[model samples]
Target: MNYLCEMSEDKSANEVRKIIHVDMDAFYASVEQMDNPDLIGKPIAVGGSKLRGVVAAASYEARKFGVKSAMPSSMAARLCPELIFVRPRFDRYQEISHQIRAIFYEYTDLVEPLSLDEAFLDVTTNKKGIQSATLLAKEIRERIYQEVGLRASAGISINKFTAKVASDVNKPNGQLTVIPEEVETFLEKLPIDRFFGIGKVTATKMKELGVRTGKDLKQKSIDFLNQHFGKQGLHFYNIVRGIQYSKVKPNRIRKSFAVEHTYFSEIYSKRKILENLEQIALDLERRMKKKSVSGKCVSIKIKYADFTQQTRAKTVLEYMSTKEEFFPLIELLVEHLEINKPVRLLGISFSKLNTEETELDQDKQLTLQF
Candidate 1:
């Protein structure tokens, strides 16, 4: 099923965009390996080894043993017995990220950084006047290696969605290009689970409906999709046909800062819940302080053993950053929560951030469709 002819007829798709998504090769784990020569070529996990700790990132060697980010540290250790765990150095990572972004600005100002490790660059109009985005991506990756001492991978395509997905096709210091003509076949053959935004739950639901691939998804009627997925139905319809319009916004403001933990064992006691909340509050405070931001709203997220989740929030008169300022409010919110069910996860988030007032411009805040 080709979409090129139909896309060319649409005014919104008239402009042929050139976007490149560059993602670092296992960023956190790679940084650890680079800094410490002794850790080279070894399976390493960057995170805590304590009980209830999650793997923040895993080196490629560790990944061979099925260790992955967000996996329980104990599970990761069980997977790879020799996996060396290293603490994350955010300050060091941020320092390196700044240097990498500087390299991106040399080519184009339309750089949308998704994280410290990956970003989308709209090189349709660039400072270097580079016409071939594939060539430009190669150059950028090469520059990142030469200047920053880190290997990077890139994907070049007509839009950000396809570009981002294509980047993962050839990873760990490699590049891929999904040209304008190839986007249709590329998406059609792709598994529904590999469609970037689709998670495990959604993919399982798609499979249950006999939609295992993009080809299968394209066969379903818009009405049928809407009935099942609601508003996101149109999103699936458009993206599969290569019709994403989300631009690479230069200034992407973070809306909130949160800290969450899924416990190794469920906590049924109120005292245990409060103890966990206090620990989460300390982490949240440290993060907020590092960002030098405060918020008026404090929220607590609770997930039960049954996988049901609930959030309780309280808004205060003034912005607060310290745990002391917000912990009491968190305690108050927790007091109202039902404790009949065992809780598997607990989280704390600060919203209505002070940074929003200073950094946000309503007109520039474009919602990413994907």
Candidate 2:
């Protein structure tokens, strides 16, 4: 059923932001095949041979067999008996990512990387003096193929979120453009699950709320959404109406260090929830140590059996880099939550970050003063 609504007064149809999203097609697997011709046309998964390891990337051939990234190696092997597992070469991926970024810089310096495989570029004004963002997308994709020896897909839209969603419309090296006037029509027919910020859990919740399409989502009152979903509710209210104002934030700072655990079975016990939270906190601590950074805010995310999720966060007086500093705060956050329903997921993230300070040598401070 199509959910229908009149255009909200908050939305505008002006095509102000010319955004392009470029996504490399099956990047890691494709790179492996490129370097080793024998692997071409074969079903391969890149991650590792370890049975417990997860698939980091799957070739198109592997994907056809229901193999996918994050699938355990053992399960992938079961699904595709001939699936070849290759260790991830992150160094190589980084090198290739640099090459792609160089190509982007040649066109526009407004590139914002989503990952090694995908990025958003605002080419409303470009270095090449090109007027059509659509044409520039085509050129960038061609350059990636010719110079980087990889196929890339492009999506051109009025904004970043729509551009990101459009890029997935025709995958494995294709382009789609959503023009200024077509934004509403484009979003109206799109599935709720395909909306940029909505995850699987959120999509399921939306489906339960009779919000199956962007049109359906638009029908809900902003107050009703905010009452149920908090700040994200307002975000959904805006996006469905094509009201996103998020710019392509270049050099976006890392806001949080997080880790989560999805339980195989629903967890009902508060003690078990705390245990899981502790492990996640320890993992986050390790990650922060490795990065040599810390933050003042600690947040706990909980997803219930019904797939409804909530997060509670607090900013403390001092930088928190270890479990000892975060666990108590997490405990306080959890105390306020209603965990009557079985918990499906638990996570901890540290935000409002700061780099740990090292005392400067007195002589260095004096030299700087001089």
Candidate 3:
């Protein structure tokens, strides 16, 4: 009787705020379904209005046929002949994103949005005082579906990295949580490729050094890992230990937001290169609009067919968010670029975001405290 009473008392006294990450699966396609009932049963792909356009999202039905985002629309069609490609409606997407953000704010202002479809919320001392994070994730997912006609995946863990990874374990309305005791063991046996922060380039490098699994990575000395891969090696070390302290940055500053694309065949002509940059500038404009900021610095990235890369940046006289002004910055970037080498990829980024206050530099750089 004494032990039971103590347990009950502790449960009431020990109130810890829980952080939860919620990610919508195929968010754009889901929104399309919500708008059009006929599209619900069909395989949908969002984006691809032009011949040069790419797929921004693919529904689960189309995913079975290997369709994916960032893939060329032509290639996606080749892969899934039945795929229905639609032009992106940014207004609709933004409206839905706002609705989701509003829901998160209703719970806690501790919400840190990673993207339109993904966010982390800290509800440690919330009004609801919910105990189970898993149940909370379920309720949030249900609310999203019922109110917005969308599906979302959720991950609940002690920190952001683990929660983000756990959210992907099950997709398309899935929710998973990392119980405290199981975290370490679960990370140890995980494949290096699946480990957070290990991108394709790093994975290839790790394989060359015989580090295929998380267990394999666990064997390496910090000195050895750092000597080879720089600070990223330190990241590998922490994740293996199942100790990531990275906080959900309340509002990550829009510093140098850009998109790049690699061509199957490199282009040699200057006019063609300028045309491609124009397209990238348009995408940059869209992203800047979404982030709600104008940037004073515009930079361009160029990669050669030989894998050699170069970047040029210029601090403009003033902030600009529209494509009209942003393109001139690209023109300035092209002025300094070398045309001798064929262009494999082209990218554009804008930095020095303008908001009510310029304090974003420090907050945006909030170290992933692992």
Candidate that scores best on lDDT: 1
Better of 1 and 2 by lDDT: 1
lDDT of each: 0.88, 0.85, 0.77
Instruction: Candidate 3: list runs displaced more than 4 Å.
Output: 1-17, 49-52, 257-296, 301-311, 316-329, 337-348, 353-357, 360-370
lDDT of 2: 0.85
The residue pairs in collision within model 1 are none
TM-score of 1: 0.82
lDDT of 3 by residue, 164-283 (tens): 778888887898888777776777777888876788999999989999988888898877888998867666776776556555567655566778876655688878889998988788
lDDT of 1 at 60: 95
Each candidate structure's TM-score, on Cα atoms with residue i matched to residue i, is 0.82, 0.71, 0.77
- Cα deviation of 309 in candidate 2 (Å)? 16
Sorted on lDDT, best first, the list reads 1, 2, 3
Which residue runs of candidate 1 sit more than 4 Å off their true CA positions? Answer: 1-11, 50-52, 259-294, 302-310, 316-327, 337-347, 353-370
Q: lDDT of model 1 at residue 212?
A: 98
Top candidate, metric TM-score: 1
